[model samples]
Target: MECRFPSVPGAERILSDEALAFVAALHSRFGERRRALLAERDRRQARFDAGERPDFPTDHPGLSDPEWRIASVPDDLKDRRVEITGPAERKMMINAFNSGARVFMADIEDALSPTAENIIRAQINLYDAARRTISYRDPATGKDYALGDKIAVLKVRPRGWHLDEAHLVIDGERVAGAFVDFGLHAFHNAQALIDAGSGPYFYLPKLQHHEEARLWADVFAFTEEWLGLAPGTIKATVLIETLPGAFHAEAILYELRQNIVGLNCGRWDYIFSYIKTHRKDPGAVLPDRAAVTMTVPFMRAYALHVIKVCHRRGAHAIGGMAAQIPVKGDPAANEEAFAKVRADKEREAGDGHDGTWVAHPALVPVAKEVFDRLMPAPNQVDRQREDVVVTQADLLTPCDGPKTMAGVRMNVNVGIGYLAAWLSGRGAVPLHNLMEDAATAEISRTQLWQWRATGTRLDSGETVDAALIDAAFHAEVEALREALGEEAFAVGHYGAAADLMRELVQADELADFLTSVAYERHFAD
Candidate 1:
């Protein structure tokens, strides 16, 4: 069959004939199943909306096997005490590798704006990094940026299954964004990565079920066979970021056991998913975004459950991101933020998590220091967390925090600010001194949806409804406009962002992903 690989300007370096064919081959093999799985997601959401609550699947055969364990993890992944995550863009890629973390999660999904240029450029960057030939120079300062003498292990995150690469088409169908990212890297750099003392490692994002994991494992098997490499040449870590993914963590690991190495409690996206999965339940309404910290009951249950399940199955349990960037000029604020990061990492390590994530290079040492003290070894998988028991009630336990009008205003500000930055080609944004990603925006918009749906009362003695939210949103916009000035605000796409934010939060139908909707309307060609 003929393959029609769509062309994007400056994509030629990565889109070699063989690479395009590799992607096309994957599409031909698994595209239909990918579509079917997405359809299943819609069906499951429908059922949930119809009052079916998520419980452990009754028919999963692995649940009955008390003695089964995942395969031993590879050496490179064993000591993931501190990992840094960032976009796959060129400069960010160079900076993260030099961040002194044990692993660098090169993200093409949530942390990146999936513009066609960005996607293709990211592939090229990964290829260069794998070849140890990646370097950059500042256009203005002439400062050279390159790999450090000491570098972190590289783990690339492809776009989630829900995203389609509109720039890449074959047989009159757009290619799955996941396949495009995975295929190019696997084709051009998999062996090169192996030669550099690492393999083609990955962090699978937004998996809703074990079947989706099964599809990825199948892709790995096929790619290995097609490339004449040994089976299991790839290792994957599933981000248990969805409510469904959290419920079936063990089954997910089991499905990809031969090639799966770990599971990360992606806290932000999990919160977003929690709100989204139960948007209809008045009982499921969450408190203010800031109030709903990891120490909250439901989040705590999830963290403990993931650690227990991962340790029981002989895989690594990685912790979530501390998204605070250290303050530049304020020493006291930096100290305070560092203290919070230290405390958070200490808790994760104490709970038997093998590693944790940080968003900025500056915070890497803070996270590393905590793990270094608590974990004398590479990991604490032997801890087993046998005493940690989680029930469905625990997972479903509502957060016990007060909702406030201040939190509402903060959400409106951060959501619109992030969307504006995202629409302007920046994905990882800093708003109110916190490093905000798509997950952060998801929480903001989803909270807006839930608060409006449930008419949640805020601490100010006012019930949250459409009018209240709209007023807050407009107020935040005017405030931003005044702060940013006319020229800056106009260039920031604040108006478009405001429209998009309202559409997402106030729409009759909830969107599964803000990026998925925004990408088609604004970013896609």
Candidate 2:
């Protein structure tokens, strides 16, 4: 494929003669670099594949053993009356620790300014805060001295690709590390956290491809060897925000399977991605200032995809942030906001999401309440039927009907795509019907696996075989083509999904007809 750069104002254009010469020279240099990188990667992968004594740290020394457990908040805290931090912006970290969240991510990537010096200072303060007890005043009462311990905190640094001169400071000192981008940085940060007597865990952001995820695992292995951390000690929660990442959700999850602890839907970034991906005609895409509602169908699909992916992996599928609440406000307004937050939490819980994040400390109580009500306690398994049950009281209940054989087919096809992508080591692929968009193979496979295990009843069913799945997938693709037209299958500019499907088919690693069906479904346009 020819590389076409996006047209930016004032961008320089090369003359034909200069461009040809430059291309030749660039190719020669790039070929050598690529060869060396690939050779090194292979050498490292060999050691990893052989399960040789890893050079980096693993849970081998019991570093992953929890040294401290934060106290659980009371049910009343769910009323959203608790306040963790002061009103100042800097207080966000302190507030989160006090707000009763099980995990507090000191975000240096997205939430904070992308300046390296500021990031280092923030990290140092956060580290200092984590090691000591802090006090805050009670907002409700005129009381002073409400003591609180630091919660489980994790620091997220900018990815190597995005890091400028600003991301070099760690504890006021320059730390030499490759800034590969979010996926790689996550593993690197996990290693750093583990080395610093903290847990090996992180919240990864801006992930767009399944290959990126596999690369993360590779980097994690490298970090483990470098730092002497245990394998499987570092866990990550990937933020599903961008259009590419959304479609590739299943692939990413599958690649990072055991290492992933949670999956989060990033609503804002996703909205931006959707605008960029779908609005082919620049004029049709809305302006940056447009106010689009978050409740659109695409957003819902993205959210549902995240939830499905996490559930399949038995990992936590965390809901998006509710940043609408005020940090401090009128009592009545605050009460109303808290009430609304409570309702939102109830809805998410009903939808099967394990937990959610809140930007304000004041919102934590309400958030936690919703999670507690929805989540089965660690000790409380099998309290309900194994089927996908939805009481009338549940907010998002499955429609009542005899299971549609067509729906079953769709699920089965989705499963084949999942298995094929996994076998081929792809993160995501286009769905059978939607050539313009893609779904994570992991998500499709998980849904199929769940459906088969649970049965086709409105509430639950049992698992189907690979044969059934393959048949269903092909059928769905055909049905979709008939509905959306052949052109719908044409992903004019999107190559990741098509390329991945092609690789899977060419390799024939999956079931015989699986790749063929996917290719026709995704590329027949």
- TM-score winner: 1
Query: Which regions of candidate 1 fall more than 4 Å away from where they truly are?
Result: 1-10
Kindly give the stretch of ten consecutive residues in candidate 2 with the minimal lDDT sum: 80-89
Query: Please, what is the whole-model Cα lDDT of each candidate in the order they appear?
Result: 0.90, 0.44
lDDT, residue 108, candidate 1: 92
RMSD (Cα, Å) for all candidates, in order, is 1.6, 17.8
What is candidate 2's lDDT per residue for 1-525, written digit by digit as tens?
132222332112221333323333323333243334445534543453343321212322111332321122222221221222111113455656666766665554444422223333443444344344334456789555432644534434333221222222323422211232232333324444544465555566666556566666665555555456666665667788765566566567666765666567766556544433332222223211113333444455556656655555455666776654552547776677678678766766666666666666567777776666666553111222234422212211112224445555544445444443423323223343221112223233333433333332322343344455556555655654565566644432123333443344223222212323443343222
RMSD of 2: 17.8
As a whole number from 0 to 100, the lDDT of residue 289 in candidate 2 is 16
Worst 10 residues of 1 by lDDT: 1-10
lDDT of 1 by residue, 335-411 (tens): 99889999999999998899999999999999999999999999998898878888888888688787988889888
> Against the hidden true structure, what lDDT does model 1 obtain?
0.90
